[model samples]
Target: DIKILQLSLRSADLCIESGTLDLSLKILERAAVRVERLEIFSGDDDVPIGRTLSAKYYMLRTLLAWHQTRPDLAEHMLCMIPEEAINNDLQLASELADLCYNVGQQAFSKGQFDLAAKWLEKAAKHNSRSLNAGDENSPNVKLRLIILHMTVRAYLEQNSGESRTKSLQTLEILISYYPNELAVLILWLEVMMKQGNPDHRIFYNRLETLVHVIELTDTNIKIILSYIQKLQEWSIEMCVRTLEQLLLRMPVLSDNEQWIDRLFVISIRLSTSSGVADSLSLLDAVATHLYDYLMKPLSQTTANASLIVRLGINP
Candidate 1:
């Protein structure tokens, strides 16, 4: 049991660093097995130590499994967490919220919009309650709320006509309440584009405001750059699509020379950083496509080259 516990802890640390949720859950299950074995060996006589440990193990295992798969199960387990379990157990509560957030995310990924909404709403409410009760502010809680807003926006994207109008109204409400969430803003831009009725000027203005509000200190820059680099590595197509959307929408953005220059530099850097020849070649092709748009005369250009450049396209 001790060996399994040590293995689980090590795996959890690695998974957390690498974002390997599935592997982490598998290790956690092993730990849970050991905990169960220990409980059985200690006898089911309702001893205080055994019961307490059982509850703790069950909570952790349930949370970990939920993070990997069905969140509803996690929610059920959350209700079982003893009040005594959380008296000084900030870690336990935080873990529960994190699991709930993952459940919401899994539902969103599976396109179970209603279920996703419910789970996310519950997670957000739980986090808020914890915060209001003077629990330490968990960054995970804020992140979950941001994701919930994003999922809500995504759900609205599939509707049409009157339903679309209703979705937009709901999205606007969410945005109004979480105005400072960058992920929400980004998703809102995406939703607007998907609707084919984006207010480009307003969107760009908001993005600009967000960029300014974000600190550009060395540490912040490093983190932002790392994120950009990771995205470039993991999903070049996404980067290209984002650029394409920006170009298609923001006309005045082409006039932003500084932003355009920075984007070009970033693209070049990313292209070179990618060691794979094929990946670099693909990036080059994207650069060329972007260039064609940028070089076109403003009178003839249907898309904004400057915006593309700002998004790390060469053109």
Candidate 2:
């Protein structure tokens, strides 16, 4: 039975590689029968043989079900496999991770956001469980990034709160690894804003790093606007200060008019709001800067200048 099982496994793999789904399913069906007759059950991570092999077997079965267009069956087959068995086998875990990630992304492309999120979460579990944190080289960082980003995107599409939580956790680890990466930094800020009442200081502190990011793309501008709105509610003074720092860091002569006016209006709201009665001068400083750069011809020369000015002027 073991000999035939090996032959079936090998033949099924070849069939899968050769695009012969029916043949692969037939081989896997035969293997499943022989394996079931042996009555092997999955066991603890340290335990080998029966249980571990069963997990691998089920994984193959799951793949066959997937190719057969039976996602329900594929999902069920995957659920039956003990996570430990896959986690202990790095190669198996990575393969499963890739498979699930691909399926999730495919689902996302089709606008099946909720299902995409579920599959990506499963992929994250498979990859994370196998990751040997103590070993400097265990988890492939690139794959980890892909999983985190896709999962975050899935949640964002659904407008679910999990995007903020999952991405925040992943961002902490990812940021130190890719601090200078513009897209990741922007994402981190957006997630920071989405979080429910995270310490106001978190956004303020993030600005210390992110404000210097040169490109003021529309997405980044949206995140900045969100951050400013939150800061107004939390501390108008901090909002003004952050805006000032951002302007200083911005490339000279930006021309993004929309945001320049938006920022000026936010500053105006802050100044008029009751909390900053004694600090109207702070608002004045912000207003003056906006008028000098955003409304003037000098600021409209480049996208950078336009963007910088756009945030300064009010409608």
Candidate 3:
């Protein structure tokens, strides 16, 4: 049965390569069932043939879903494989990574960002082997960078803590590659905010300092403002603290006038969106704070601001 299943897997792969996935799917599904039978005896692991069959089954399932316009399902199928099993098997890792990297590209083309992020993160998790000892300009290396970039884009759309934390390593590598990329810097700020309450000053300081950098163009500023809007929706209190901290740091970082004017621009947009009257607008809170920042800069430091030491103590 093992021999028959192995033969069927090879034939199924040939069918796949020949652009006959219908036939390939049938063969692979049957072979998968047979593989399960073999697994019952081999304890489902570490036996070379059994592991090979199991990996091939899941990998083909992923591909079948990928080519069928079910990228979300493809991602889910791949995640069904145990990370430990994939990590220990080179063939499994490569197949999984390649399938996901391709699926992410297709998802990006269709603007399915959430699905793209899930697959791209899985691709990033594995397949470093192609990049591990190769030329930096190799096709695989370029592909990995492209995946990393798209993963950042997709992660931005979702803005979840788990995805942000999972992406840190690849993101740090990307940041090193594009040191001045504003989007990457924005992602770093979000990660810092979620890292811990004790590190809030560090987040505010980096955000303030980075905004003063030459890369903070109108588009990037808009992106940060949008993030602030989401933060407001997610936690009104944290949003207020962010605005207050940014106002406090603006004076030391650059001309306070410029930052205040930017806030006014953002306030106009927020007003336009909500059609709120001027008397009770969001800017009123900011307006009052603006007065405090201008009139009593040293007197208005919040307890939160005073506690943070601005990158002096690492998070």
Per-candidate clash tally: 1, 19, 0
Which residue pairs in candidate 1 have backbone atoms (N, alpha carbon, C) closer than 3 angstroms, thus clashing?
291-315
- Clash count, predicted structure 3: 0
lDDT of each: 0.55, 0.68, 0.63
Q: Per-residue alpha-carbon lDDT of model 3 for 123-178, expressed as tens digits?
A: 87776754556366655656666778878767666667776565666667777765
Better of 2 and 3 by TM-score: 2
Off by over 4 Å in 1: 1-55, 64-75, 83-89, 132-138, 157-177, 189-315
The lowest-lDDT stretch of 10 consecutive residues in candidate 2 is 297-306
Model 3 TM-score relative to the real fold: 0.48
Question: Model 1 Cα displacement at 155 (Å)?
Answer: 3.7
Ranking by TM-score: 2, 3, 1
lDDT of each residue in 1-315, candidate 2, tens digit only: 656776778888789778899899877887888777544442343255555556767878777777677889989998988676675687778778877887788788889888888888888777776566665455555677777777777777776566646556666766766675666666776776666676787667776567776466776666676767776668777887787666644435355555555665555556555455533667666556655654554334333433443354422
The positional error of residue 235 in candidate 2, measured at the CA in angstroms, is 3.0
What's every prediction's RMSD, in angstroms?
Answer: 15.4, 7.1, 12.9
